[model samples]
Target: MCGRFALFTPVSELTNKVGAVMPEREIHPRYNVAPGTWVASIRQASEDSAPTLEEMWWGFRPSWAKGKGTQPINARVETVATNNYFKSAFAKHRCLVLADGWYEWIKNSSPKQPHYLCRRDREPLYFAAVYAERDDGGLGCAILTEQARGSAADVHDRMPLILDDDSLEHWLAPDLTHKETIHSMVRHIDAGLVEHWSVSTAVNKPSEGQGDELINPL
Candidate 1:
């Protein structure tokens, strides 16, 4: 699950890459973006308009949830289409969760090492996500995950559904709701396209602010 991640890429760079308008507010660089925080997302404005950037809560809360428990931050791709909590969003609220990289802890090791996972070419990782608005006007989003493969499998059993440039448009199409067509667009990115390395354990703690030290190799 994508419990922790980082997105320190400049706002201007993101605007250029995704063709979305810059967020009006100044966005500070983040190194350890934890769950429950606001995250940057890209989604189509309408059926015929360009995609736009939005800052949404990093958890999914359905309108009927009544705000009483933990919201889900990651939804399994295998069951997202049929699960009650995620089906509607899965069908209509698709989005791109922007990040430069994410951190995952290796299991069965004393003082488990945290690893940074990202594209081998150092490009941004556009995670597949879905969003929904709560009754109180709050916006929430959840990252989609598929079974882990390659080196990522050694760290955890699951990883975010990272989308390529070719998949972005279809993944964010506002009117595409056919289950099979949508699911087909959410295929796994080849493991060879990604790389991972051990990083400082400081990421184990949740805090805000940017620092290269957080992602520095250990």
Candidate 2:
């Protein structure tokens, strides 16, 4: 699961990289983004094919959620299509979660160590996610997860469902609602597209926010 991530790229760079128009909000750089915080995501509107980038709360709360509980931070690809919390969004509210990289903890005999993972060539990546809007106009999204592949499996059992530029259409296409098409679009990202490294455990705390300390090697 993608519990923590980074998005230090500037808004202008992100717009050009994702080929989406940015909103007017004063965007700040974030080197250690955690769940429950607002982050940028790209989604298409029905009237126009151009992608619109907007900020959305990281955790996902289904419209049917009752009382306060842990909103799902990640949705398993294996069960997303059938799970009540994710089915509706999985079928229709697909989105691309923009990020420079993500963090995962590796458990060992000692305390867990945090590792940063990004595209091998240092290019930006977009995680395939599903989102829903509440009546109050708040937005929430769930990062889709699949079985870990390549070197990533050494650190964790699951990884976020990442999409490539070529697969962007299939993922963002609103008309392709068939279950088969959706499942096909949810496959693991190519291993060659990513790189990883160890970083300081300062990111273990959500309030640490963005700083060089978080990415500094211990």
Q: Measured by TM-score, how close is model 1 to the native structure?
A: 0.93
Model 1 Cα displacement at 94 (Å)? 0.8
Tens-digit lDDT track for model 1 on 20-72?
Answer: 87768878888889998899888875787788888989989976778864599
Clashing residue pairs in candidate 2, if any?
Answer: none
Q: Which candidate is the best by lDDT?
A: 1
The local lDDT score (0 to 100) that residue 160 gets in candidate 2 is: 89
How many clashes in candidate 1?
0
lDDT of model 2 at position 171: 78
lDDT of 2 by residue, 34-100 (tens): 8888888888755367778988889888656643545888898888888877888887888888888
lDDT of 2 at 96: 85
What TM-score should be assigned to candidate 2? 0.90
